[model samples]
Target chain A: MYVRAHTWWTILRIALEERLVYRGDFALGTLMRFLPIITQIFLWWAIFESIGSGSVETAEIANFTFPDMVAYYLLTMVGRAFSSMPGLASGVARQIRDGEIKKFLIQPVDMVGFLMLNRIAHKLAYYSVAILPFALVFYLCRGYFTAGWPDPLTLAAFVSSLILGFLLGFFLETSIGLIGFWFLEVSSLLFVYMLFSFFLSGHMFPLDLLPEPWNLLVDLLPLKYMAYFPAAVFLGKVSQDELMLQLGIQVAWIVFFIFLSRYLWKRGVSRYSGFGG
Target chain B: MSEQQPVLVRVFLTFARNSLVREMTFRTNFFIQCVSAISWTLMNLGFYLIIFHHLNRKPLADGSGWQQNEFFVFLATTWIVFSIVQAFFMPNVQEFSELIRTGNLDFVFLKPIDTQFLISFAKVDWSALANFVMGILLLTVGVWRLTTQSNNPLSLNLANVLLYWFYVACGVTILYSLMISLAATSIWLGRNQSLYDFWFYITNFSRYPMEIYARSWGWSLWGLFTFVIPILIVINVPARILARPLRPEGPWLGLPLSGFAILATLVCLVISRRVFSLALQSYRSASS
Candidate 1:
């Protein structure tokens, strides 16, 4: 068991090294991804200036002050950085379609385990390189963080939510990829999934700002855990009791997704046909 | 040039036919792709509906902000322009690097045709037309609501409507220039897979009202995007022509900006053409 654990450790180490090979490009990409925040900031400023009576204190749209709105946007970016899986689903689907996945079946490796470790390595590398950009951007927007840092307990909850968000994102994407067992082409499905996630995950705007029926319905979905909940926790928008309850719900969703993915993989493997073999 | 125009038309028609045939080979895939595009359009519409609902009571300080119907018109214009780019140019530009990688571009060069024209119109993404249709539908609804519901109904003259479409054409041209130039960089960079990511970043600027970027600090951004990239005028000018033909902010601003947008389109096309030529000169065939 110790030896097996060590083998996985080596795999993770190698994957981390591989990611570092493209560190420069990755870092630049991360910074470039934040460019949209320029427009967001401008748009919000305009909105508040128009709606509110000159000062931010007067502009309370859906209980979000201008500073709170700005803070929420920045925090959501952090949450998204943790949870957004860029190419995992399409990469897995391509591997499955091309029959490269058969190598995992024959080798002494589980595909999902291997992928998960690689993804963990990727995150480790990403966060290490991405921290500088996040720092710089946040520093530029420090004035917006009027409420300052959360307390230790809330901070801890925020961190936990981010980590869980990552796991949930991974499993969700993996399950989508596993659908490649039945369908050779999953790109369209993946595109549709991405669209839903972009809107539903609160990446566009705060979920609370959305009107009724939508606000209530989107809350039930797991996507809010990826972006909205973590930021909400950080801003003290969610109370301790609600945070705990939401965290519990998040864990439930993650566990449910994991089991569903495992079941799909098992069923898929039985039907999976290696093209040449 | 006039005689060759019909030949160009024939070539484009043939290309469109071949593309359609290729797409039709997998009918289920084509249907799925269409559904996927439509779903994204619906989600975006829904999202904007929520936002506009929140801002229902609050107009801009100078009445420059797009209200529910006006903003929907802007959104529809965005979709139309984006759809045209995706359908006519994006798929081709995306494949340019692959063509270089696989050495298929050598054959493209050998053909008796304008390589840029051929490369730009090679593949037609028919599924993207789903969003184009959706955009028109939304535009009609938005315009109807704008005329009927708003206290101050905007005038929509035939000349302005014609100019709106002309500006939309200009927008498409500018996007094509930008994309082709970006794709040409693949010759030097060798497999630049982040083209789409970079494209999204730049185009996201055009998604909202140009007036938002006219604030104090936004002046520099306005200059950069207007003169440097010219993406600011792409969707905004056309949308404004339809939704509010008479600019409440400044009357003279729209005419001069529209003229500049047309000039900018021409300048972008020439610059992109030059860039593509230079990049092609630097290209080493894959076999070599």
Candidate 2:
């Protein structure tokens, strides 16, 4: 067990090193990503201005004042940063299609465990470089956090939700990629997944803003845990009573996806033929 | 050189035909792409629908003169412009760095035809035209709604329609100019992976009505995009002509908004052409 843990640690260190080598461009790219927030500020400001008759401070649209809306968007960006697995699904699909899965099958290395560690390393490296830009943007928009920082207990809930969101995103995407075992190409499927994820995960807008039946339907899904839920928690939108309930639901979804991915991997490997090599 | 114009047209036609053939070879992929594009449009439409629903079907929150139907027309115009860029120029510009890195650009220079023209029209993703069709449908619906509404001042005459299309062309030209100029930087940067991200960010400002940016704190962004980048006019001028024609009294410096759009398009084109040539001169080929 000790040797195995040491091996995984070595894998993580190498992955982290590989990511840090590209840290220069990573910082610039991450800063560039924040440019859209300027547009968002202008847009929401206009919306609130019209609604409040030039008094944007008091305007509330869908329970969000102007500052709350801005803060929500900023917090959602943080949540998305945790959950976005840019090319993980497609990359895994490619490996399966190219028969690279044989490497894991032949070796004693567990594919899911190995990939999860690599992803953790990737997150560590990404956040290390990205933290500066995040801090800068957050500082510039600090006025929007009108309620200021959450209480310590709420902060703990927010932090835990983000970590669970990360795991849920990873497992959910891996399960989709595991479909490559049956279907040689999953690009089209991945495209569909991306489209749904972008909308359903509340990256585009808060799910609470969704109307009637749609909001209710979206509430039943686990996608909110990835983005909307954490942002809502930070903004004190979620009630104290519901916070524990929501976090519990997130854990349940993560467990469900973890099992689903492991099941697919086992089934896929059992039927797998080591062709060409 | 005067006769070369006809040959260039022929070459463009050939490139378009070859691209269609290539697209047809992947029938399922093309179908899926069309579905994906349509799905995205629907989702965006749904988002706006919810927003309008919240406002009780009022004009955009800032009173930007964008009622639901009028905004739909603007949205349609955006989709039309975007589809043209996506179908014709986006794929080519995205692959510009790849061509540079792989040394294929050297062969592009060896050709007798205009290098910029050749590179820009090399491939057409026909599936992206699905958005074009969707845009036309939405445009028809929006126009129909506008004409039928009582007390609406919308004028759906032939002159307005013609002017709308002409400005739509100008909008497409401005966007194409911006894209090509950004792609040209790959010659210096070696690999401009952020080209798409930057393009997405810049063009995002053009997606909404220009009035949104005219307010406090937004004035600087409004100035930057309108005068310096000129992207703000791309969709705004065209959509305004069709959706809500600006009153003649509001002309900027004796020129109508559409007139300014035409001038901006010309300036953008000239600037991008100069930048492309300048970048090409600095290109160190793969062998070097």
Candidate 3:
């Protein structure tokens, strides 16, 4: 167990260094990415004005003000910053397709263990550089957070949810990549998964605002934990007990996905063919 | 060069046909690609549907008196413009870095063809045309709903339809120019991994109505994106002409700006062409 732990630590350290090598490019890219929020901010402003923003009683949309909506969108960006594993799945699929999986077979590495450790390293490296841009942008738009900061407990829950969200994302994506073992290509499947996740994960809007059946159905899914629930927790939407319950649910889903990925990897390796010898 | 126009046309058709054939080899993959594009468009449609449902057709102040259907028209125009670019230029521009890395550009230079034209048109993503179909469908439905649902619908005339298509063409040209110039930068950068990221940043500004950005806070964005990049005029002009004509606030600017957009598109194309040539000149082959 100690040897195993040491091996994974080495992998994480190397991955972290590799990511830091492109620190400038990563930071610039992260900053450029927030540009889309400008359109969202404007669109919500128009919506709120059109619906009448005179007062809480007079406004047509009662639940969400323009500032609230903007804050939600910006906070969702933070959630995505934690949860999005940009090219992990596709990278895995490509490696499998090109017979590059042979390296793991020849070496003393476990696929999922190596991938999870590498992703942890990647996240650490990302947050190191990315926090600057995110902080700068969020500071500029600080006025949107009309509700102000959350209570201490809620803040802690929000941070915990983000960390778990990253784990869930990595496992879910790597499981999807494991499909490449049976299929010649997985890009199409990955595309479908991405499209569904983009909507159902509440990246587009608050899931509560979605229609009845959809809201209920999306609540049952694990995706919202990655985006909506964390932001909602910070907004004080979820109660203290509910926050604990949701975090438990989030951990349960992560465990289930991790096991699923391991099961798939085991089954895949039994029939694997490395063509290049 | 004038005498070679027919040959160029023939070569383009051939390239497109070969690309289709190659893509068809992976039948399921091709089908999945189309389905994927359509699904995202549908999701966007659903998202706006819900937002508009919340609005209940009230006119937005910053939306320039736009209601549900008028905004749908704008959204449809965005998809159409984006799909045209995706079909024609996206795949080629995406592969520019790969061409440079693998030294395949040597073969491109040796061909008896205009390097820019050949590189841009050599690959056609036929599945991306699915979004074009979806866009047209949405636009037709939005226009129909606007005429029927609104109390004072904009006049739908032959002039508007023709002008709408003209502006769409101009919009596409401007977008294509922007993409080609960005792709050219890969020669200097060796590999621009964030090309898609930057592309989204630039294009996101054009997705909404220009009116939203005419405010005090958005004036800089308006000036920067409208006159400098000229992306705002791309979708806004066509959607405006067709969806809700001139709305009195900027009637003179509306008609005159479409003309300027055409001039802008031409200027952008010329500039991007020059940039591509300059980049090509500076490119050292892999042997170096």
Q: List model 2 lDDT by residue over A1-277, tens digit each.
A: 9999899999999999999998889999999888888878877777778777667878788899889888988898999989889888888888898889899998999999989999999999999999999999999999999999999999999999999999999999999999888997888888877887788888888888887788888878888888899999999999999999889889999999999999999998888777896
TM-score of chain B of 3: 0.94
TM-score of each: 0.93, 0.97, 0.92
lDDT by residue (A196-230, candidate 1, tens digit) is 78888888888888877788888789989889989
| DockQ result, candidate 1 | 0.57
Interface RMSD (Å) of candidate 1: 2.3
The pairs that clash in candidate 1 are none
Candidate closer to the true structure by TM-score (higher is better), 2 or 3: 2
lDDT value, candidate 2, whole model: 0.88
Model 3, position B157: C-alpha lDDT score: 79
DockQ of each: 0.57, 0.69, 0.62
| A1-277 per-residue lDDT for model 3 (tens digits) | 9998887888889999998998998889888888888988777776776677422224534366677777888889889988989888898888888999999988988777788888888889999999999999999999878778888888999899899999899999999998888995888888878887899998889887887788888978999987888888888878887888889999999999999998988898888888856
Better of 1 and 2 by lDDT: 2
Which scores higher on DockQ, 2 or 3? 2
Fnat of each candidate: 0.57, 0.65, 0.80
Candidate 3: the clashing residue pairs are none
* Model 3 residue A225 CA deviation in Å: 0.4
DockQ for candidate 3 = 0.62
